[model samples]
Target: MIRVAIDAMGGDLGPRIAFQATQKILAAFADVEVRFYFDPQHFTVPEGASSNRFTSVSCSEHVASTESVDRALFKRCDATIFRALTDLAGEQVDVVVTFGNTAAMVALTRYIVGLLRPKLYPALIREMRPAPLKCLVDLGANVHCPADMLTGFALLGSAYLEARSDDAANVALLNVGVETSKGSSVIKDCYQMLSARSWPAFSGFAEGFELFDGGKNVIVCDGMVGNAVLKASEGLFAFLLSQLSQHSMDTTAVEKLVRAENRHGACLVGVKGNLVKGHGRSDEKAMVGAIEYGIDIARTNLSKKIEQKLIQQGVL
Candidate 1:
């Protein structure tokens, strides 16, 4: 059975959305179990959430988005978010899902379960496009990273895609231009290193305009650039979709941006355990989507595969 620990005190809705979503998930999956952690003083289990597969644990605090990482780590260490992750670290659960403060979740998970060899922190992975599917790494995890760290991100991104398919992805660095001298020193250094590597079919560079052009399967970059690119794409798509309401423009692509799948959260790759961070304003559907994604990730055993791949590539 796959067990998932959820930080019920997370997101904007607190335990309400978490509890309701848990009920939806329990109704859909038979072999899954959930453990919800919440602030006992403010949260109560919602109706229809009572089931043998569900477990509720009371926590003393909730990590707020505005809270500093240090404060959350030291003062609110016993917060529902941390408690849920602690359960994951102890092997009591298969995965941990949260809509809590992104910084807190990342910091605590790294401090607790530790990084998966060579990773300074986890990289968030998200799917891109309608037909020729691909994954984008480091969506917003590390704003600034070194060359070698970017290399590790590439390896983690490759392993994630490899777990789902046999085809080797054509990886490319996201940059201002395809020219080698276009980006900053860090990006140029990363480009040089990736170009020298043999694995993952390094496909050179990709610009923002070429994200969905179907030339590259995986795009790699520092979190600063990657986050900007992702948010811009999401925003642009939302804008275009809103304008074409009367003309019957296909909103499938735009829907993919607004849908629960991407909004649910991004996986914190490079960690020993499965950890997903939902959007801060995640609703019931987004919460359920995150848990469902966690279940799929558990079945994939993604972290183990990532470790083995890193070791095999001598990157570990």
Candidate 2:
């Protein structure tokens, strides 16, 4: 059985979305069990929802989305994210899924669960839209990354795709233009670093429009640019839906195609165990999607595969 620990006290919607998502996950997957960490003073389980597969643990503290990473790590050591990660480190849980403070979650994961390599940091990797087989790295983990960090993200992203598909990943660096001379010095340095490797197929640089064109299997970028592109795509999806509705067009197909791409949670790679981070403002549907995504990661043993890949590539 796969055990998933969730930070119920996190996210903008509070514990309600967590509870609702838990119920949905419980009904959907019999092989998966859920454990929620929440403050007893703030949340209570709905009547008659208890089961052997679903359990709740009482936590006394919560981490706000605006909480600084340093404050969360030092002052709010007993927060829900901290408790969940501690359990993860202790091997009590197979995976952790939370819609909490992104910075706090990444920082606490590194401090608690530990990283595969001390010099390498964790990154958020998610499958890109219109092409679920392709992925983007550094969704929002580290906003300012150096050239070596970007190269590390590329390695992590390639390993992630390989873990899921059991095939070598074709990687590309995201830039303003496809030419190597278009981006900043950091991008150029990363390109040179990746070009030196032969394991993961490097396909030069890629423009933003190439994300959905199926030109590459993995696109690498820093957290700032990745987060900006992610938010922009979400806004564009919403605008498209609204326009379609006004035109009295059938929006079911459009929603079905874009919802999975935009709403699924991102996997925090380079960490010791499986950790999935949902958006801070995630609704019940998005929360459920994140939990399911965590289950997939645990079942596949993704973290171990990534570590092995890194070692094979001499990046460790």
Candidate 3:
């Protein structure tokens, strides 16, 4: 049985979408199970969610307010999210999925499971995109990072790429150009280190415009830069939508379902648990997609894959 530990309190849709998604998932997969860590009777399943596959656990407390790394580990003991995960222990579930505060998950998971000892601040991000298909790291967990952390991001990104695409060695560091010396000194140094290293198959620096090229799998950068890039991409898309805002565009109710799968978020990779942080302004479709993504991730045992790669490359 594959168990998905969900932070029922997280995300904009809260329990409604979660309940629906849980129902949809259970209906779709027999082995999939959803354990909602929400306030007891906080909400009800939409219509047909009371199946044998879905169960709800009441969490008296909630995740910390801030996105600090400390909050993830220091969450209130009574918090539903933490309680559900605590019960998960080692074998009950596969991954923990959350659309809540990003930093809180990181902090709490690290505190509970400890960092990847060798790669202390391993890059925990999501790359399941629609158009660009970019594996972006540090969407907002850590504002500041060093070279090794960035390199670790590359490794994590490579692991994701190897699992998702045919282009495994196509991983690149986010840069202004494909040159060895590009961007800030820190970035340039990381570029050189990765370009020289044999691990993760670094493909060299990736320019800003080349991010959406679809050939590159991994794009490593600091959270500040990554966040800026994400905003810029969203702004560009919105601008394009405005420019191409058609009066008779494909805005059918069916389109809403497709848009949901285009979720923007990343999963926490380094920690033992399976936690994904959805974009702050996620909709019902995105929320459902996130839940589905959690299911796929849990079934794939992605964390174990990364561990194997890290061990093979001596990163562990």
Best by TM-score: 2
Clash statistics: count for each candidate: 0, 0, 7
lDDT of every model, 2 decimals: 0.80, 0.87, 0.68
RMSD of each: 2.6, 1.6, 3.4
lDDT per residue, candidate 3, 128-197, as tens digits?
A: 3544456778677777888878877777777666655555546677877876655788787787788788
Candidate rank order under TM-score: 2, 1, 3
lDDT, residue 86, model 2: 92
lDDT of 2 by residue, 171-207 (tens): 9999989887789999999999989988678998998
> lDDT per residue, candidate 1, 182-215, as tens digits?
8888888888888888887897888876666766
Off by over 4 Å in 1: 246-263
Task: Please report, as a residue range, the 10-residue window in candidate 1 with the lowest summed lDDT.
Answer: 256-265
Stretches > 4 Å off in candidate 2: 129-132, 260-263
Rate residue 282 of model 2 by lDDT.
Answer: 87
Cα deviation at 305, candidate 2, in Å, is: 1.4
